[model samples]
Target: MNKVKLKIGEFSQMMQVTVKTLRHYEQMGILKPCEVDQWTGYRYYKLEQMQRLGAIRRLKDIGFSLDEIRELFEEGSHEPNEAQLEEKIKACEEELKVLLKRRENLHQMIDSQRKFKSMEKFSIQSLPEIMVASHREVIKNYQAIGDMCCNVIGPEMQRLGCKCSATGYCFTIEHNKEYKPEDVDIEYCEQVEEMLKDSEIIQFKKMPAVKTALCLKHIGPYDRFYQSYTEMFKYIEEQGYKIVGDLRCVYVDGIWNQDDPEKWLSIIQVPVEK
Candidate 1:
């Protein structure tokens, strides 16, 4: 009986792996051929290397990166040291946490898309003035909107024992001309029965009503608000309306009011000039 050494092509075919992947593994220093012909620079692998290749495939399937794989194999044996195994296991756990968050976000987006396939066109309307408790913050992400509302506005309301207006009118006044999720200068206001004592975090202020504006109702997640805006802006320009003031995003249902993104409803109000 004689041991067989297979060329790269033969090894790839027998291992049921792509040649490209094999080359990548070789470059990553995790795998190498048993012999290379000097004249032609061809790689050859012995039958014994099959077990190592199988181990590499399994490790990849378990979410180990090439760098991690390199570290694992740098021990000169497939038998992983405790520190190596611990590091890989820790990495896998961190990746799983990120994946779970991404999965949840996808579910919210998918659910919202299914809820509203089409958004309503912008309609011109007059907005009435209202007194509100307002706060402005420069935050890193849009999700901070909810955090500020919960931590600042909600607490202020509770501290004052204030009564909310029957209108349920709560909105964020976007100061930026365009949507900038990070470093957003938004003034969030919620209508109240009466103004409470001014606080550094949140203050009672009045929103000067709009005489005319382009308004569109968004009936899904905030992430899908872009869709409504895309359609609304088209309608606005076609109608000959020039935007005059910062946009107002009125929240009818949001994270505070609804658990499912499908139930969220927002109204985008673009103050416009005739």
Candidate 2:
């Protein structure tokens, strides 16, 4: 064979790379033309150079940057070290794990949005006073609400053989002056018709009747309960009422009664002053 030589344009077409990319690779010292015309200053490449261009594209498709591709090409035989390749694979795996978690959170948010469309109508109601067996804690996070309820308080009540009252109004009181996921002050109260022995964490107490509260029925995961809060406050602002006390959330159905998040029911109430 005459050892074919092609102009830069012809070689670019043959290798499926743009002229600009060829010039960039030349500047990056990854790919270079075989000849430059002394008079017209045109660049030319040999047909054999297509193999190098193919290698560049292959490395790029596998997420290698131009610097990495040049280092790969400089590795004597155009084959990367096994250790370096393994490190790259490990980094990619970590990135994939992060992306998977983000995708899961996105789905949860989308599901929450779908559930909010059927929000229940709210009312400003005069809530009656209630007596209860209760446990209060300043927790680290919102999940601690479930942790303290399921692990500590519920088990303790069962151990003591205390039964829920016939009325069965179980609710939580948030005592934080402002909403903060961390360092949350929570009071878990369950109506118990009879008296029971008390621990420092658990006691009997009364939640005073509210003259007026913006209350809404929420049916979904506790994580999505903020939608209820949003709607409740919107109504409160519309009616010209100032928030007077901590938010009150009554749990009608929860993990203790049901396994499905969609089946959980909460009544969110905000005390307001007219």
Candidate 3:
């Protein structure tokens, strides 16, 4: 009986693998043809190589890299070491966590879109003059603003026995003369009943009333604020209105009160003159 040998193409077909994959395996030194015709540079594989190919495919399907497979083959063991298998499991678990977070974010975005489809997007309203307790800081990023308000500013307000206004007006102002990617200069203000003596952390000031402001409701995560800004600017230009003062983002619902970012509502008020 003669031993069966097959060309690279025939072996690839029989093993249900690609010729490219076979070539890669050869380069990786994990699997090589049993013989090569020197003159034509043609490759030939013996029948027994089929078993090795099967093992390689199974390992790869279970998240094993070609390098790992090569190492396993070099150790003269087709089965992975216990430590190697545990490491792969840990990596897979981490990947699963990332995928789960992404899925949750997607669901929040979908719910937000559905709720905002029919809701009013823009409005013009008169803003009343109000006394407010304000705090300013250069924060790491926009996300850190929540923590700064809850932990630092909120405590200072309570210590001073600040009286919050019935209107429940609270907003943030970006004081930076120009845009910044990080270390944002932000001022947080909450409407109060009366002015109080300035503290190291908080200041009392009366905000001027806006005669007419273009308000745009932003629905969803703070990271998506740019979307609302883009629309607001376009609308302002179309209406031939000039923005008079720095924009104020009035927070209605946020991470402090809502678990879902999609449900968070903010009204961007840009003081404008026609």
Candidate 4:
């Protein structure tokens, strides 16, 4: 008998896939032969299998999981409908969003580790209750607030005779939501012995005493402080402590050079409960 159909081996060779792989796809219901010889139990592929084989290859190239591809094909006709194409597009978009978020987090971690290696470790100690002269505003721009801290806030502390305490600086967000960088309330403060008698920009506020925290001493560049925060949180978790209060970042030294992140000294403290 002159054969009109290709056997499994012939199809696999033409498609550049192994016979085992083709059999597995069959088991997965992604690809099934048009007919099987009853006596020999040999699978036969018609010309149509070539189209299915090409589709499977293309879908796999786009990061589709085998299970997902199988589902797609199970519901799909020989020619996919608009709805099916839309489903594939949506799935790929969702996967891209997840991958992008993971990439951002990893990049932040790498930058943080580099900064951590340059820091000197210090012991955690209790901070005394202190009075702070502060300025409160609904900060719409965090970058501007950061600038205000380095320029307006730091000098104000120096003038008030309230040198940077070892406890670090505190920024309390009164109201936060899906806020732009400029729309958050940022309060910048420093401990002072006495309130300024005549000051327009500075006002007095009491900082509530925190009992415990997993504190890490980080000196040099605020850019690396995120790494310090990440480390402190991990340490707190490893020690079986839970964060009980808002995190505090105390600026110890403020150099005027915005270009140099290596010269800034800051302490990051995460309040915790043992």
lDDT of each: 0.82, 0.81, 0.92, 0.70
Residue-wise C-alpha lDDT for candidate 2, range 145-172, written one tens digit per residue: 7678889888888877778878677788
Worst 10 residues of 1 by lDDT: 113-122
**Every model's TM-score:** 0.62, 0.69, 0.88, 0.46
Candidate 3, 136-238: lDDT as tens digits = 9999988887899889988999999999977688999999887786899999999999888999999999999999999998998788899999999999999
Q: Could you give the C-alpha RMSD of every candidate to the true structure, in order shown?
A: 5.3, 4.7, 2.4, 10.2
Least well predicted 10-residue stretch by lDDT in candidate 2: 112-121
Alpha-carbon shift of residue 186 in model 4 (angstroms): 1.5
The TM-score of predicted model 2 comes to 0.69
- What is the TM-score (0 to 1) of candidate 4? 0.46
lDDT value, residue 268 of candidate 3: 98
Q: Pick the winner on lDDT between candidates 2 and 3.
A: 3
Q: Write the per-residue lDDT of candidate 4 for residues 1-274, one digit (tens) a residue.
A: 6546899999989889999999999999989999999999999997778888888888787556778788777777444567767887998899899999889767766665576666555345555567787876776565465677777767766676664445554543434545454566766666666656536667776677777756687755554556766777777778888877666666655554434344455677666778
Best by TM-score: 3
- The candidate 3 region of ten consecutive residues with least summed lDDT is 110-119
- TM-score order, best first, reads 3, 2, 1, 4
Q: Model 4 Cα RMSD, Å?
A: 10.2
